[model samples]
Target: MARKVTNTRKWIFTCLAWGVALLIFFPILWTILTSFKTEGDAVATPPKFLFFDWTLANYREVQARSDYFSHFMNSVIIALGSTALGLLVAIPAAWAMAFQPGKQTKNVLMWMLSTKMMPAVGVLIPIYILFQRMGLLDSRTGVLIVLMLMNLPIIIWMLYTYFREIPGEILEASRMDGASLWNEIRYVLTPMAVPGIASTMLLNIILAWNEAFWTLNLTTSRAAPLTTFIASYSSPEGLFYAKLSAASTMAIAPILIMGWFSQKQLVRGLTFGAVK
Candidate 1:
């Protein structure tokens, strides 16, 4: 009787889990469906789910209306550029905090994490003014720097956690072998931490790719990424649901493909230190 009850409970939980997963995925599925519909069918009063005349008109119109390639290139540059910069700065910082702790190290880590809690908009005006004065506004270099700094704390925190899992004795042995600080990190430490670093890179790329507020506020035509590309669809005339959905689909497709492919690496990295 107890074994039967356990089986029943497992089945119930499995169904619940699937239900929640479907609920979360419904919006993306709906968006992809809408992207195939005409503008009228997209925003119909009765909310058309699957019963609509699917058309390629929206995709074609969106392509003709916007330089999709340029926006895609901008997104690739910004996301990759910012993530590369973040890793360079964060790796060493994490190494120090992980291996050579001081009295204030914990305090400093907490302080860094605390910054993430602050509302981004609160500092936007100051950052904008600084950017204007420095000629950073609407420049790829400008947005790259901003995105890198914005995501830096998370990068440091994640790398620090991964580094901590590594035994310090390995670095100590490297030191005994006359491995200079740079060589120790470059050769001994980094290779061991590849999985963690890869995961960190993937996550930071996603964060930078999805960042909308800063991109919208800082960039005009010259430096605008996919976020701005999607935003351009909004107008006082009202939403072009089908076209907007198509643009949205295009903007997100690359990252979605990337995330899907790299999910195993991400999971492996996340679980790097979970076991002994």
Candidate 2:
């Protein structure tokens, strides 16, 4: 009877979990479905759900309207560039904070985290002016630099957590073997932390890829990413629902595929220190 009750509970929980998952996924599902509908069907008052006349015209029209490849490449470049630059800075900073001792380290970490609590709009004017002066506005380089800076704190925090899980004795053993600091990090620290590092990189790439506000405000035609590509469907007249949905689906597809493939590694890395 106990075993039967446990199984019943498990089934109930499973159904609830599926329910929540579907609820969360409904919007994306709707967007993809809408992408296949004509504009008239897309915004119908009754909101057609699966019974509408589906078509691929929106996708073709979206392609005809803009250079989807250009925005896609821009997103790829900016996301990758920022993640690489952020990792370069974050790894060492996290390493030092994790392995080395300092009186103000905790305070410093709290201060760094505090920056994220503030609204992006608060600093927008200054950053905009700086980018303008530096010739970065509406440029890929400008957006890349901004994303790197924006995600740097999270990157450092993640790496620091990962680095803390690695035993200090391993690093000590490397030093005793006459390994220099660089060699110790390269050989001893990095290999063991691969999962964490990889997950951090992946998460940051997703964050940068989906970042709409900065991408929208900082870029125009030349440097615009997929977020901007989607926004282009909206105009002073009205929203092009079908075309917008098509653009959104295209913009989100790559990152969605990436997250789907990398979820296991991401979950494993995120839970690295939790178990032991």
Candidate 3:
């Protein structure tokens, strides 16, 4: 009787989980479906779900109206570049904080996290002025720097957590074996913390890729990413529903595919220190 109760509860929970997942995914599904519909069908009063006439006209129009490939490459560069830069700085910082105790380490960590809570708009004017003076506006390098700084705190915190789970004795033993500091981190610490680092990188990449506010405000042509590509479909006249849907679908497809394939690694990294 107890076994039967447990099984019944398990099945109920599983069904609920799937229901929630589908609910969350419905928007994306709608976008994809709308991408294949005509403008009339996309915004019909009754709203056509699947009975609409399917066509690739919107996709073709989106492609012809904007430089999709250029936007795509910009997104790829900014996302990967920012993640790589963040990791470089974060790994060392996390290593030090994890292994070396300082009087104000916890306070400092809290300060860093607090910065994320402040609204981006609060600092926008100052940053914009600085960017204009430095001529970093609408440049890939500029965007990369902003993204790297924006995500740096999270990356460091995550790495610090993962590093804490590692045994200090192992690092001490490496030092005793005459391994240099660089060699110790590169050869010992990094390999052991691969799962954690991988997850951090993936998360940061997604954040950077989806960032719209700064990208939209700062970029006009040169550094415009897929977010910009999607925004182009909106005119002062009105929103082109079918074209906008097509643009959104194209912009998000790559990241969705990447997330799907790397879900296992992401889960493993997130759970790295949970058990032990």
What lDDT score belongs to each candidate, Candidate 1 first?
A: 0.86, 0.86, 0.85
How high is the lDDT of residue 227 in model 1? Answer: 91
Q: Give the higher-TM-score candidate: 1 or 2.
A: 2
Candidate 2: tens digits of C-alpha lDDT, residues 1-276: 999999999999999999999999999999999999988998898999999898999888777778777888999999999999999998888889999959989888778777766899999999999989988999999999999998887888778778788999988888889999889878888799887788889988988999988999999999999887767666724658888888889889889988986776555433433333
lDDT of 3 by residue, 76-174 (tens): 999999999999999988888889969989888889878877889999999999999999999999989998998888888878887788999999999
Q: Which stretches of candidate 1 lie over 4 Å from their true place?
A: 1-4, 44-48, 51-53, 177-183, 236-239, 257-276
Pairs of residues at least 3 apart in sequence or in different chains that clash in candidate 2: none
- Where does candidate 2 stray beyond 4 Å? 40-55, 236-239, 260-276
For every candidate, C-alpha RMSD to the true structure in Å = 3.7, 3.4, 3.6
Among these predicted structures, which one has the highest TM-score? 2
TM-score of model 1 (CA atoms): 0.83
Model 2 root mean square deviation, Cα atoms: 3.4
Model 1 lDDT per residue over 1-276, tens place: 999999999999999999999999888888999999988998899999999998999888877877777888899999999999999999888889989999999999889877877888999999999999999999989899989998888888888887887998998899999999989878998788887788889978988999988999999888999998777766625558888788888888878988886776555443433332
Give residue 58's lDDT in candidate 3 (0 to 100): 86
Candidate 2, residue 138: how far the Cα is off, in Å: 1.0
Lowest summed lDDT across 10 adjacent residues in model 1 is found at 267-276
